[model samples]
Target: MSSQAAEVTEVLVVGAGQAGIAMSEHLTARGIPHIVLERHKIAERWRNERWDSLVANGPAWHDRFPSLEFADVEPDAFATKDQVVEYFEQYAQLIGAPVREGVEVTSVRKRDGGAGYIAETSAGTIEARYVVAATGAFQLPAIPPIVPADAGLFQLHSSAYKNPDQLPQGGVLVVGAGSSGVQIAAELRKAGREVFLAVGPHDRPPQRYRGRSFVWWLGVLGMWEASAPPQGAEHVTIAVSGADGGHTVDFRDLAASGIRLVGRASGYADGKLTFDGDLADNIRLGDENYLSMLDAADEFIERNGLDLPEEPEARDLGPLPADALEPIREVDLAASGITSIVWATGFRSDYGWLQVDAFDELGRPKQQRGVSVEPGVYFLGLPWQSRRGSTFIWGIWHDAKFLADQIGIQRGYLEYDGNGAPSNFVPRERPAVAAS
Candidate 1:
């Protein structure tokens, strides 16, 4: 390649969100030339896809990058959707990330001679010695094909949902009892709409325990460092909330708040939707995980003999309402007056543009950490990519540093001695950034 090569930089990073920004920060700190390509503006998902009432699940302190703090906000407060986007914008500006927004990357393929990768984009073809796909794990909303096509009912994925007013005036059956589903259901109920949430296998950890935020506990306890889940076990989302200055997400409270709890929506037929008889079982399993976490925290405090106040309310989220424990067998959408269905059913990894054999049967990338089997191709911002916190904004910083170190070694900016460890190779700071 000549100095006048028809390209921008050596390393090409996709997406300008936290992951891409973090990777750009590390690469910049290591004096590596790179360009961050984003299909939309920075923090596009938070700015657009989320609902009006959406708040960050994690506290301000634990959720933000280490480089910048949320300005004019309490550490324990949960930033709103706009505030979160502002924080990302501030962080990217502070780091001077070389982000090229509105440039959509269509596909990435291995170059001939196996030397580099070619990224075909809306702008044009760009070549790079290495490619990092940080587009995000939640690409397409994974709405199950459970809804019959001829049902003639209005349906939207969680990503498309904005406010209660956007939906028609009628009862709403919210599928998927994850954070989004539960929160959205509660909001709809509060708006004077009948809401029924289909409960699934979800883990509920309190927002605060022993007078400390759960985010603090997870970080202090190193719980997020755990590896991926066992095979065949789905990674269920944790049920906790940072809304209203943070609170424990209790289903019993939601039930009491007029949001009926139903079992998982299983099938639809005869103008009625069927449910699995697993609501009680799912709640029981979540309680076990919940109490186990509290017990672990209690044991840690006792073992260390630390002086901390215990909040009894965290342990007992009031009694579960009797009717809430029972599951409704089926729901007649028409009779129930349910005119809208919100599928808060999470998302699927859409790497269709990635023309590489780096994924498994489930469309999950086959890699140790972020390094893919194909040389010069890597991935980031994926949930459980390395640890449980691999997808968190703060958590992804650690992953980005590791990937940057690996890239440095591969690009000869860093080195490993005979001991097969990183040598004492000095790193260079950011140089004058080239035009993206």
Candidate 2:
């Protein structure tokens, strides 16, 4: 084996996705010496995971990067996945962020000197004073391995779904009613193929409520405020996942469009998929619950004297065309023309490679805002990392700025306030980990 020397960075960023990119930009803005390590080409997942016909499930105004956005894009509209990726790419180049692509961080471990951590990557090892784990929530798609191999049916996860042409001409079974699942199902139905959407616990927000996009309300609600806690910081389960959480389909529109609503998908074998008998009823109930939450949020806004426009005034844009809805229904494989299965089952957060001791019971890393239990270690890009918008591209700027401040304090670049949290959570220092 060739011997490789270790490189040192003031801050080492893991993952080059949206969150990681934002961190890089913030560090650059602060004139902090840092490096970004990515497993794949930047934004490769978006180019790979999305189908061709896919559009942003929500409006595009709220889908921009912190302080920057798609120039001249339509308002209260959605951006296609490709458009989103292009925007990120442009943002990265604009910031001139130092990114080392195709380097996968296999593991991160604290050094014995107690100064910082060492990141072991395929290319080489990087010793850094701080490591920002910006791997987003959608790292691993949660696919249930229940289908039998003998079923003689094609199966692939949403990450592998390129386009409808990649699937067979027959009908398709889409399990998991998350954003990807719902969007894929709609596309399949539009292709004139019989599609079955297995209802799941999905967050269904109105596409255009009252007269504005759902994200507008979130912004006006201080959901994206910098002082708010990170997404998983609190044990409180959010009432709605919003656009980023799950499928934002309006069930009324889906049903009205002739989409076949079926029960929750259960075990499958012998090329046959089983679902709960209460699929239709459950879907109806889920829709009702979602609508109720929207109403409640609206009420809270009015009671608190928030700046939201009245319902009618807010949703002046009105919902998309009713025909814009995709038709769906439950169908048995042999009888239905569908010959493939696409699992849009959403993704689960995976921290298998992290050697840190800050994870909570739900496999989420513990952090007060972005500061973790470990000193010189932090995380961003989690669901609501610092507020409702923390995870969103537009929402991440404040978190990045806040994290930069904390890092500065830790490194003595910025002095810490008295009685505040300890500047260095890890005791003892070796040669000043972040020396210029």
Candidate 3:
């Protein structure tokens, strides 16, 4: 830390991933003076943390910012991990975003006897009238400690997982049936390794349906506008893949392809692992959600009187694979020959440096849309922050725009009426937007 006086700015944006870049873009458009502080290189998680075989779940068109996109890749194709990172790098350069990389913010708090906030960082302290926490979603990977530490099985989180060869030579057990787990299981099975997938509550939507991508259908069906999850459907994840030109996610398909299907990993004791007994019901629910999505799409097409081809295979998912119906309740690790476990159980917020009283007990920010209870402090890039789409690339762009708009209101650069309509809005492009 520098012993000099604190550096001051009009706004300070944290984290230089998609959300931060998006926020920077909007601030630049509005000619607002701001500085973006990054803990590492831009798009660091996508560049280093993700698995080697990782690909965007959404298609390229849906996963890019409005101004820039990936070249040479098909619009319908999902971006590879490298491609996604490269895209962001190019986008940041093109937008001329003020991203000061390698500067990590350790603590952010209200300034004493001042009208704004102060961010303590590795470089020095930064004072700003407003701060946008765009640290992104994958803050910390959540790995449950269900199995004992001395269980003697090699285990790692999905964030640390790369290719199939990184694991031990024996079989692998992938817990959590979300996008990460299923993709890893599929990749391992492709590598001739016996894989056991622990199924959890997931909505297995296909990569495409009726001559359209699943995300396209969601956009058309107005499903992405949902600000909150329906009752009992909070933890459910859509398990579709965009690797190898995209495909549907089917546990039965995985089972038929030599990968074993099991229930959620519940406990392990007496040298035997136990799974939940509701495997059948879980599979049944996934099938229902799958068909219902297609049904809803079909109805939307019919209601709108659109000429589109129907996919017969999507309409009928067929019976549950016989193996999926049988729950693998308990299996001794030695007996099953399972040598490794991959916990792709998703992530949780890791905002210890954020010292504002705007978070829930679970460390989740308490906010409506991107605006927090704390004035001049905002959040971005959270799923369903404003809508379900807010988590996706373009959605993050829109969310960032909304946050920038709010900041614009605060900066007196714009104004909004009570109904949330902009009363006097002007976003000019002026050089040197950020002040000392």
Candidate 4:
């Protein structure tokens, strides 16, 4: 390896996704010298990994960075993958974000004697006083290891799946009935293909309730603020779709849309895909949770004495009928003429390059919000980093700005109060508060 001069910056932010870009904007606003390093182009994940037809899970009105809402676009409409990519690109330019694309950070290590940290990247070494691991949570695709290698069927992870045309002319089995699986199954069915969806544990909220978006109700009930998982608890995967119209893609909806629903894919056996015999139970659990959320929202409205219209009782939210609750224990791919298996199992976090002890047993960073254990180290774009909205496109900016303020105070670029806190530390007001 050839030795090169190490470029130094006040802050080095890894990953140029929404989180990183947002952080860079804050740093720029504070006149902090920082550089954002990305392995690919800005919003590379949305640009390259997501399906072509993918849209923002949230509405355009809510999917935005601070001070930069979607313009000339329908606020209630969902932005597609391409539009999202373009939005991030425009945001980076608009904020004058100092980003260095195509620079992949290979390793990050704390410098000797508490000086700072050194980041090894393809473009050479970067020494920074502060290192913000703004890499989004989804670092690696998580396909179950138990998938049969000799199944002799084409396989694609949700991150790699583009469209139904990419699959062979046969039935498709989609494992994991989360957002990705349900959406892909819906697309496959729309393309006139046989789709089998393996149901899993997920939250099934109606896309719209009482003539308003379900997200609006969630905001009304403070779900986003209160939905943070207990510390060390696994985050719940909410099953919702970003497709046109922002429909809810629950197990019931998939089953009712001519897609066969099965239980959780357990493993392969007897030359077939084995599933648990709890399909009905899983569906019931989702329905119960959904109803509970609605009840909570109703209670919140009543308690606040809000002048919202009364929602009708006994409304049909489109769940699976009792007769469609038959459990599917196994599926023989060959017998069913299934040619492809789409694994929407979800993503795993990878911080192997970060040589720091700030990680927990599960390899997740240990932090009280975005500030890591080590001084001058921070994290961004983590799910539930501070609240339920921390990982979303519209929500990460709050964490980013908070981190920027902290970094500014640490670097003496900003002032701190007598209480040893950043003077600029102030909670951002929720936009939905007035509207609700």
Candidate 3: which stretches are off by over 4 Å?
Answer: 413-436
Best by TM-score: 3
Best first by lDDT, ranked: 3, 1, 4, 2
Which tens-of-lDDT digit does each residue in 168-242 have in candidate 2? 778788877666677777777777777767765544455555455666655655545645553443422222222
Mind giving the per-residue lDDT tens digits that candidate 4 earns over 122-182? 9999999899998877989998976676768899899999999889899999988678888
Q: Each candidate's TM vs. the true structure?
A: 0.92, 0.79, 0.93, 0.90
Question: How accurate locally is residue 326 in candidate 1, as Cα lDDT from 0 to 100?
Answer: 61
RMSD of each: 6.2, 7.5, 5.9, 4.9
Looking at model 4, report the run of 10 residues with the lowest lDDT sum. Answer: 314-323
Best by lDDT: 3
User: What 10-residue stretch in candidate 1 is worst by lDDT?
Assistant: 1-10
Q: How accurate is candidate 1 locally (lDDT)?
A: 0.85
Q: lDDT for each of the candidates?
A: 0.85, 0.70, 0.87, 0.82
Q: What TM-score would candidate 1 get against the native?
A: 0.92
Span of 10 residues, lowest total lDDT, candidate 2 = 235-244
Candidate 2 residue runs with Cα over 4 Å from true position: 221-248, 256-258, 293-332, 360-363, 413-436
Clash number for each model:
0, 21, 2, 0
Candidate scoring better on TM-score of 1 and 4: 1
- Predicted structure 2: lDDT: 0.70
